[model samples]
Target: MRSDQPNYDVDPTILQPPGTPVWVADEAWRELARAAARLDRAVVVVDCYPGVDEQAVKASLERVFDVVVSVPDEAARPTEEIDALVAANLGDDRVFGYITQFNVADLYDEARLAELRRRVHERTGPIVLMGWGARLAAPDADVLVLADMPRWEHQLRMRAGMPNWRCKNGDEDILRKYKRSFFVEWRMADRHKQPLLDALDYLLDTTISADEARLITGDTFRSALDAAITRPFRFVPYFDPGVWGGHWMQEVLGLPGDVPNYAWGFDCVPEENSLALDIDGVRVEMPSQNLVLRKPIELMGPGTFARFGADFPIRFDFLDTFGGGNLSLQVHPLTGYIQEKFGMKYTQDESYYLLDVGDDGGVYLGRKPGADFDEMFDELEKAQRGEGSFPDERFINRFNARKHDHVLIPAGTVHCSTRNTMVLEISATSYIFTFKMWDWDRVGLDGKPRPVHLDHARANVQWDRDTDWVTSNLINRIDVLEQGDGYRIERTGLHELEYIETVRHWFSVPTLRDTQSTVHVLNLVEGRAAVVESPTGAFEPYEVHYAETFIVPAHVGEYTIRPADGAGECATLTAHVRGTEFPRSVSGEDLRFSGRSAS
Candidate 1:
């Protein structure tokens, strides 16, 4: 079709002589078989054009189907007569319909189309249409139009400008065609929705007004807030300013102001991490206000930890700034190593829930197979001594992260969250974790090179040959279940103190049953559930409209849950001590641990 070439019809082989065309005999029979087979399904053959013999065609289709109907070619036939012919074919096993091959181009009438639809519904089987008739068939009629009559891939082939092989251009053409044809396959995303909401939310929230934070994490926060549809919540770690080197964005995460900045290199809130979630209509607040510790003696002032009690530890702040940059690739040590190495004073297990990512955005985790530790250490030694740079080529495995994806890290897994995106991090208690490696060789603002802990990192890195340190734990997954008022408690992991779970109901449901005492943390993951206590007045149910975590004491009373605030069906997560029974909330004491030592 292009101007460079003269037009020449590509003739099909039907006109070739029987013997001269080597492939004609086989092709003719195949066509005869197919055309004849399609005709056999109807009770009467309806041919708007009159070239073919009805009896012979009907005879040929006898083996495959019962009947065939063909329309009279002469225009002398009335619509009623044709209609009667169609009705006559309507039997228990046979019915009449139309095909696009009829070639009735100008026969499109709304009245006739409506009548056809009524007849189709009255008939038991489908109404078939072909070619031009297919274009006029009633919507209710089942239409089976041939897709390849004009060669469906004609446009694609023309776009490629080549016929021999599919090049990138050809592949793209094919992909574009596929995307256009399929529902989920080819649809373009509505990109502005999240961005617009994020901008508006930033404009309204005068407080927490760090422009860097507003720019980087606004989409993530807004998208999360805008999700009115009830579904499982996923957390990703895209906002860590620790990634992309020590950018100004990282500093903004800790502080509250500054804009047009990059990563906020330092954290301001050193004691506790916080998340502001608007669950349903409820505003549930959990602040990191209790992480201060009273050491043997305070150094400069009261330490952040000394002032806070047995509340939550491990704080992380929001940072937003530079899109892409360099950062260390690392993971944390497992629980055993932390207890052994840090004298049982640290706990850190985390995961990344990426909210946004770039085309080249990636995270590097673990080392590749056959990676020589000696060689890696040699590079590390040079980098640490300010001699050379860390080896960037060999050890890392990159993964293309995306929005609403959760990647769980159990610990001792060498990993780094990298480049261009916002992410939410969710993980277990205890914040102390070791960084395994760094890539860039730049000095910080302090005029000293950044600290590198190669020995500690190498000691905790998982080196198993079969393990895929990068993608092993990163996936979008959730478990949803239903149970009665007195719930089903099951153990999901091995540790004796794996976790504690407890459920208490504030309202009495007659179905509530008595259960044993077990130490556990109770979280209203979904609908509101009530707990009944003998001492305290009827307390409101733990409302979990958003991402809220709450602790349930070991011993609680007869707790019953009824639907709260007109909300039906509640979902809750209870993590409990191993091999223990559910505790009664009324007593506030666990007889099982009445005499146990604090340690």
Candidate 2:
């Protein structure tokens, strides 16, 4: 089965939430009821996405309040019309509360939203503005309830036509339209929603079944929200299949083998991933962006947050090609190019750290020295037009792979992970800007030729990054930084183009480390398992296994890592922003290694 196809048979019970507190449906309803009873005229606004059961909430409110009025009887209306209707209904003497839907999808005009907010505010009675853009319009609402769903689930629901708000187009057209609108819509929505998170009176996770929906409110919600932003966290990994996907993940990761192939696994992409929160034995998933919006400073630290507002600077994911074909020969736009072209703050600067590989595994990186670029592109055009095959080896340099080999791929550098390799990609979080130059002359899983971006690739490719330069600078460069009683730390890679630095620790005993106010991304690259513990009990200890990635929040201050029981020696690779002050380091440590030189 292709990954893009809907799998309705997937068991909901398999979902396990992150250990946290979330208010169950009954508890949330009861709490809202009690609040409603205490107020003579309370304006409770419930802002949510499509498919949320607003009627159920209205029913819940009606059980406590004498009169509840749902405004703008029409499901969809223009902002001006909605404003007029809301204004006309506001002064009604019999109505105790007004529940109005303010879907952002219907309105893109900021001025119109402002006008609607002004009209809604004029009402003396309590107003319950429900929908996505309500929070942005009514920032000063007495009570704000943010209803959210996991983006993946939302997409599924949309595909299933579960929401009353329907797109006029067919499913295929709907999917195409969504794909085109996703980046812009999500960016705008996030910008408007993030600043209002701290003001939220309640957060409702609507990803679960209607009967099992969960909410987090009051102090418990605050605490849970804090934990989400300021702790070692993980996102529910989402797997997808591509034309060049492989069966390695299906075999090694124990994923369902029914799919054609598993190409990409989004381990911690907050933008596209969801947070699964464990609430009273029930699993509830919410958009991971809520964490960034709620507490950017806590998650990213002060300096990093200041530099890249709510955006998570670093990204960690897997790129598997085992038993499949090579990834497209690609180049990411330069920082300036990306910012000017795509309105992105940062460019995608990536590195491939080989985790596992077949006997003949290799990677295509850099350009061969003295390669004829004009002639190469002319041949590429021919290959793209189905006239001939691309001479890949002639234009690109190939390097044999080994476990734990780090291959640096900064922005503007042309590269791709070849067949029979599983690579852990760590880089800046500006994903989805790849310019593919070649795709092995294969069609997509849909049997269509994948779009090629030769013009874009040609504009960005760093021609000077020849084979010799790649051999000298882009390969594994390690330096022994310090060695203690039972632990040794080595500085792995700190390319001039990268803002983050990586270090590997080979330890046999418990090792203490401090964040120094900079977040650290850790992976147990070797050994069975390791436990990260907080000495002062500031946060709960978390266990990670081989190849599993975890984060250490900057505010955690100090933590300790030790091998799990019965596990002997272990190796963990820690990556963090450059220029962070370390708690301890040896001044004059041996920097030389046998296979690679530190310098």
Assess every candidate by TM-score: 0.38, 0.82
Maximum-TM-score candidate: 2
Summarize candidate 1's per-residue lDDT along 12-92 as a digit string, tens digits.
011111222111223322332344346423222122111112233333334333322221211123545433433322222
Q: Please list the C-alpha lDDT of all candidates, in the order they appear.
A: 0.34, 0.69
Considering only N, C-alpha and C atoms within 3 Å, which residue pairs clash in candidate 2?
18-276, 43-127
For all candidates, what are the clash counts?
A: 81, 2
lDDT of 1 at 46: 20
For model 1, what is the error of residue 232's alpha carbon versus the real structure, in angstroms, after optimal superposition?
20
**Candidate 2 global TM-score:** 0.82
Clashes of 2: 2
lDDT of 2 by residue, 389-488 (tens): 9998788999998988989898889899999999889888876677889898898776767768888788898899998998888899878877867788
